[model samples]
Target chain A: QKEVEQDPGPLSVPEGAIVSLNCTYSNSAFQYFMWYRQYSRKGPELLMYTYSSGNKEDGRFTAQVDKSSKYISLFIRDSQPSDSATYLCAMGVDSNYQLIWGAGTKLIIKP
Target chain B: DAGVTQSPTHLIKTRGQQVTLRCSPKSGHDTVSWYQQALGQGPQFIFQYYEEEERQRGNFPDRFSGHQFPNYSSELNVNALLLGDSALYLCASSLVGADEQFFGPGTRLTVL
Candidate 1:
C-alpha cells in the first residue's frame, strides 16, 4: 500500500457549501502533516500544516490530524468559487527524508 | 519580493535527449529542492540541495541529477530522458531545517 492515501476527488459543490477532504496514511512515523492547494498550471501552495494530532484553523479553512488513526482532513467553510483547485496531502518524518504525498483531491466550487 | 521562480515554462524533448530546468528560491530561503509531478498525481521528491551539496534524495535513478550554486539557485538535469519523464517539474525552497516550503510555478516537460 502507498504510504499516504487520499481519495482522488473531483468533488463539485456550490458556493457557500461546507467541504471536507480527507486522507489516510499507513505510516505511524509521520510527524508532520500538511495540506497544499494547487491551481491549474500553478505550483502547490501551502494551505495548512499541523505538527501532530490536533486541529489548526486559518480563516475559512480548518485542518485536522489524527495520529492514532493515521488520518488527516481539511475542512473549508463558506467555500467560494475561487476555492476550486486540487488539494494534496503531504507528510514526513523530518527534513532528512522526503515527504510522502497523496494522490490529491480535486475540488470545484461552483457559482 | 518574488516568492519562487522557474524558467522555460514548458519544454518538449525526445527520448535519449537531455534536459535542464532551473529554479530560483524564495527570497531569504537557502535550501532548494526538486520534485516531479506526473499527470493526475502528487509531486514526488527528487532531491534537495543545501550549501551546494545534496542533503537527501528520493527513489529516482542516477539519470536524474542536480546542482546548487553558491547563490542558492539550482538546476535539475535529466540525462538520456525517457518518454516516462514527461511531467511537471517543480522547484521548492525553504530555510535550513524549516518544515515549511515555498514552490515555483514549475516547468512542464514532455518527452516524446
Candidate 2:
C-alpha cells in the first residue's frame, strides 16, 4: 500500500456548503502533516500545517490530525466558488525534510 | 520579502534531450528541494539539497540530479530525458529548522 492514501475525489459542493477532505497513512514515523491547495497550472500553495496531533484553524479552514489512527483531515467551511482547487495532504517524519504526499482531491465549490 | 522563484516558466523538449531548470530560494532560506508533479497526480519528491550538498533523495533514477549553490539557489538537471520525464517541476525552499516550505511558480516541462 502507498505510504499515504487520499481519496482522489472530484468532490463538488454547492456554495456555502461544508467540505471535508481526508488522508490516511501507514507510516507512524510521520509527525508533521500539511495541506496544500493548487490551482490549474500553478504550484501547490501551503495552507495548513500541524505537528503531532490536534486541530489548527485558520479562518474558514481547519486541519485535524489523529496520529494514533494515522489519519488527517482538512475542513472547509462555507465553501465558495473561488475555493475550487486540488487539495493535497503531505506528511514528514521531520518537519524540515522530505515529505510523503498523497494524490490530491479535486474540490469544486459551485456558485 | 520575495518568495521562491523558478526560471523558464514553461519548456518543451524532445525525448533524449537534456534540460536544466533553475530556482532561487526565498530570502534567509538555505535548503532547496525538487518535486515532479504529473498530470492528475500529487507531487513526488525528487531530491533535496542543503549546504551545497545532496542531503537526501527519493526513488528517482540517476538521470535526475540536482545542485545547491552557496547562495542557496538550486538547479535540477535531467540527462537523456524520456517522455515520462514530462511533468510540472516544482522547487521549494525552507530553512533548516523551518518545517513548512515555500514553493516557486514551477517550470512545466513537456517532452515530445
Candidate 3:
C-alpha cells in the first residue's frame, strides 16, 4: 500500500457549495500536514498548512489533521468556478525532511 | 522578491539521451530540492542540496543526479533516460531548517 492514499476524484460541485477533500496516511510519524492546489500543467501551490493533530483556518480554506486516525482533511467554503483544480495532501515527519504526497483529488466548481 | 525559477520551461528528448535542467532558488534561500510529477500523480521527491552538498535523497536511481553551486542555484541531470522519465520536473527552494518550501514553475520533459 502507498504511504499516503487519497481518492482521485473529479468531484463536481456547484458554485457556493461546500467541498470536503480528505486523505489517509499510514505513517504515524507525520507531524506536518499541508494542502496544495495545482492547476493543469502548473506546479502545486501551497494553500493550507497545519502541524500535528489540529485545525488551521485560512481565508476560505480549513485544514484539519487527526494523528490518532492518520487522516487529514481540507474543507473549502463558498467554492467558486475559479477554484477548480487538483487538491493534494502532503505530510512530513520533520520540518526539513522530504514530504509524502497523495495522488490528489480533482475538484470542479460549476457555475 | 522573485520566487524560485527554473530554466527551459519545456524539453523533449529521446530515450537514452541525457538532459540537464536548471533552477535558481529564491533570494536568501540556501537549499534546493528536486521533484518529479507524473501525470495523475503527486510530486515525488528526488533529492535535496544544501551548502553545495547533497543533504538527502529519495529512491531514484543513480541515473538521476544533481549538483549545487555556491550561489545556491542547482542542476538536475538525468543520464540514460528512459521513456518513463517523461514528466514534469519541479524545483523547490527553502531556507535551511525552514518549513515552507517555495516551488518554481517546473520544467516539463518529454522522453520519446
After TM-score superposition, the amount by which residue B20's alpha carbon in candidate 2 deviates from its true location, in angstroms, is 0.3
Model 3, residue pairs in steric clash: none
Q: Which candidate leads in DockQ?
A: 2
Name the runs in model 1 displaced over 4 angstroms: A95-97
Can you write out model 3's per-residue Cα lDDT over B1-112, one digit (the tens) per residue? 8999999999999999999999999999999999999999999999999999999999999999999999999999999999999999999999998988888989999999
Q: Per-residue lDDT tens digits of candidate 1, residues B16-37?
A: 9999999999999999999999
**Candidate 3 residue runs with Cα over 4 Å from true position:** none
User: Which pairs of residues collide in candidate 1?
Assistant: none
Write the residue-wise lDDT of candidate 2 on A1-111 in tens digits.
Answer: 999999998999999999999999999889899999999988899999999688999999999999988899999999999999999999999887889999999999999
Candidate 1 lDDT at B35 equals 96
Q: State how far residue A40 of model 1 sits from its true place (Å).
A: 0.5
Q: What would the TM-score be for candidate 3 when compared with the true structure? A: 0.99
**Each candidate's fnat, in order?**
0.71, 0.78, 0.61
By DockQ, rank the candidates, best first. 2, 3, 1
Docking class of 2: high
